[model samples]
Target: MTAPDPWAGILDPGETVLWQGRPDTRPQWAMLSPQRLTLGVVFIVAAALWGWQSAGLASAGGAMALLPWLAVPLLAVGLFNLAGHVLWDAFRRRCTWYTLTNRRAFIATDIPFRGKRLKSYPINRETILSFDESEPASIGFAFEPVPMKRSTRMKMVGFERIADGQTVFALMRGVQGKIERDFPIDPESLPR
Candidate 1:
C-alpha cells in the first residue's frame, strides 16, 4: 500500500493526539444541491432571454425595454447565485479532517478561492474545539495566542454529506489512539 500522507508528520511532537474527524460530504452536497439548482435556473433564464431576443421576438424586445427595472433583480439573483457557488465550493474544497497529535496538530484542506492550505500547530498554546449540537454535523476549532482572533475559528470544517457516522467516529478515535501512543502526558505529575 502507499505510504501515509506526509501531512501526518505534524503529530510527531511531544504532545498526545486527542481527536480527528471530517464532516459527512454526502449530506453536505445534498444540502448544496438546491443552490446548484438555483444556479442552473439562472443560467437557463439567461439563455432563454438571449435566445428569445435572437429569435426576433418583438415581445422580447419589449422585455428588453424594461432592462432598467429588471437590472436590480437580475443583478441580485446573479450575485446570489455566484455567492452560493463560491460557498459550496469553499466548503467542499477548504474543509478538512484534523488530528491533534502529541506535540502538534495537522490540517489538510483544498480551499476553493484560497487553494490548498495544510497547516500544523504546536500544542504548547491553548487551542479549543467547539461544537454546535444544534448543527451536530459541523465542528470548529479556535487557536488562541493569534493576533486575529476572528480568523481562528475553523468554520464548516467537515464532510457536508455523512453516510456512516460510525466510520467517521472510529477514524477519529484511531487518531486519538495514535496521539496517546505517540505522546504520553501525565497531567497530575509534577515536572519539577
Candidate 2:
C-alpha cells in the first residue's frame, strides 16, 4: 500500500500534490565539491607533513617538542573537511524532505539535535526556475537570502538532489504553466 500524505492540513484547501521526494542520502565524496574537499585535503596534508616534521624533531632533540603542537589545529581542520563534511552532508540529506504542490513547494528538514524546520514558498508566475541536471537532479526556485546572526545563506527552496529531476522539472513546468494560465499574472504585482 502507498503511504499517506505527510502534509495534511498545511496545504491550501484545493492545492493538490504534484510531486514529493527526497535527496539521495548515499555517501558522496567525489571531487565535484572541490571547495570542501580541497580545503580538507590541504589541511590534512599539512597536518601529516607537520606531524612528520614533529616526529623528526622529537627524534633529533627534546627542545623541538613544541612544533608538533602546531599540527593539532591542522589535523582537526583536515579531519573536519575529510570526514566532517561528509558526515554533515549525509545527516542533512537524511533529515530533509521535499513536497511540491499545485500552489507551492515545501521543504521540511528534521535535523538531528536541531529540531524541525518547515518552509513553504508559493509557485507564482513571477518565480524564477533553475536546475542542476546531475545525478540526483536538483531544482532551485523562490530564491531568497536567509540572514543568520553572523552571516547570510542563499536559500533557493526547491526539490534538491532528487532522482529523475528532468521528469519532476517537466511536471512542475507544466503545472506552473497551467497555474499561470488559470490565474493570469498582473503587471503591478510581478515581484519587482
lDDT of each: 0.51, 0.83
The best candidate by lDDT is 2
lDDT for model 2, please: 0.83
Report the lDDT tens digits of candidate 1 across residue range 1-192: 998866455444444555565554432333445665678578657755755554554346676555444445554566556455555654563366665554555667866677777776543323343334444343333343434656653343333333344444444445555556666777778477
In candidate 2, how many Å is residue 150 off?
A: 9.1
Candidate 2 lDDT by residue in tens digits, 25-142:
8867662376777888999899889988788787666678778888999988887876787777777888998888888888899986889999988876677889899998989887
All candidates' TM-scores?
0.42, 0.69
- Residue 128 shift from truth in candidate 1, angstroms: 4.6
